[model samples]
Target: MALVFRPDKKSIEKTLAALKSYGNLVAPDARFNYDAKDGLRKEVCFRDEDFLSLLSSIDDEYVVDSILEMLKGKALVPPDAFYSKDAFDKLVALTKEKWYYPWTSFTKAMRRLFYMLASIKQPRIVVGMGIFYGYTLAWSAGPSCGKDKLYNAERVYGVDINTEAIEGARKNFAILEGSDHVELIAEDGRLVAQRLEGPVVFLHLDADGEKIGKKLYLELLKILYPKLAKGAWVLAHDVTDPGFQKQGVFTEYLNYVRDPKYFSESILFDIDQCGLELSIK
Candidate 1:
């Protein structure tokens, strides 16, 4: 459950060696310093290109390990450790495959985080607001396919505006060998919300950014808010970035969730630059 990296010299050396072997990259130098109040301060500087190249070549496990090694420090532990090893391993494999989307896609950490949330929530319905090549859809629904069936959902719905993206998502879902639980719909978020029945326990809001994305998300929430179960969880992507925060892109939506009348708790996970807002209703 220890999510913080807090790497020692040995751990850092091991990670660097792994990166070199996996990506043919090398760490130029490392600085280790200490402050009276903060204790050990460790910094490792490497080429950004090299790191990205390494990420491109390696598998999800290696990527996750490297991320943990690099970001070692005092941090909130992820809930993934609570799940069975088999379930976690399945999630890792599911995320390893390539999922193409026109814009930026979800990272290994983000996918893993989704799996953790799904395992914990075990919702009867899993809804993804933006399908986009079905990567998030697969991540949202994959855990439910486990032997123990971590998610007891009868259906998983993926809604997207782009017809081409929906087509691509269908192919992606097919590649995933999705069962009867999967449902891919090309429609507006409001319509998707209208069609949904029963309490939605897990909701993933990963639509595009800016005015369009903001409007779609707001519309969906307006319709679906009453349908959320008491302990339902919502994951809103791209809301944590400082740039978007300054622009007030999704501030209205976030403010609504932050209000005690709607949600019981909300937390921001600052992973990579892709900020995720986790709210419990």
Candidate 2:
């Protein structure tokens, strides 16, 4: 495939440098970071009070739309597939109402993209690694669950290392109707991926490794590669979540997925402050 939306390393580098130079995305005063009390991995990350407000801001939606078009252009998305905004919005509302985030940089566009992935792919098995509070997993499997479910799915699993977070996720998912198909487990992500049954169609990677958080994305992909379906899509989050500050972890990841030897195609989208790398196998 001739990818029109491949990773833009230079632009990402620039954005990272600017962010580091200016710093502190949560406030105008530049007072916090990923390590702050309510920063990156806290019980609650700083974000818009509600998802409706976040989705309402569509000024940069063209960025996500361009990516959707790219997926369609490259035939990654089915020609007959479509996702309803009303459905997606409802999913967002339900998630915001029922779920809690330990920490995330998830943006409106990113959530929409993940939800759309489910609507289009209609995967039988969906797996999420390092799903902090299950929201990421919920988004990836949105169309398969909930009252507005777009399709029926066989199984959806979310793996996290934090037992407490997984406990919270279980309770949250239990409250949401039609989410019985979704399972939350607290274990090593790599171990769970290796033990998975077969042919996972949609994989969401947000697992933080021993060293750099997102560096583990590559390892997860490598392990899951053989188990991936023919047209599987791997969504790696935080590909540029201050990656420039982490010494080329994401760069190596970008290179691996972009290379035709491993993946048929790869594209990097930085719609939100964070980046999501989409790869097809």
Give the distance in Å from residue 83's predicted Cα in candidate 2 to where it truly belongs: 0.6
For all candidates in order, the CA lDDT equals 0.68, 0.76
Tens-place lDDT per residue, model 1, 32-111, is 34332464324433323334334533554554444444323323234242444476666556545545556545766677
User: What TM-score do all the candidates reach, one by one?
Assistant: 0.67, 0.76
lDDT string, candidate 2, 131-239, tens digits: 8888777777788877788889999999999899899889878877798889898998989988887789889888887675677888888898999998788888876
Q: Pairs clashing in candidate 2? A: none
| Segments of candidate 2 deviating more than 4 angstroms | 1-57, 60-62, 244-246
Positional deviation of residue 161's Cα in model 1 after best superposition, in angstroms: 1.0
For residue 76, model 1's alpha carbon misses the true position, in angstroms, by 14
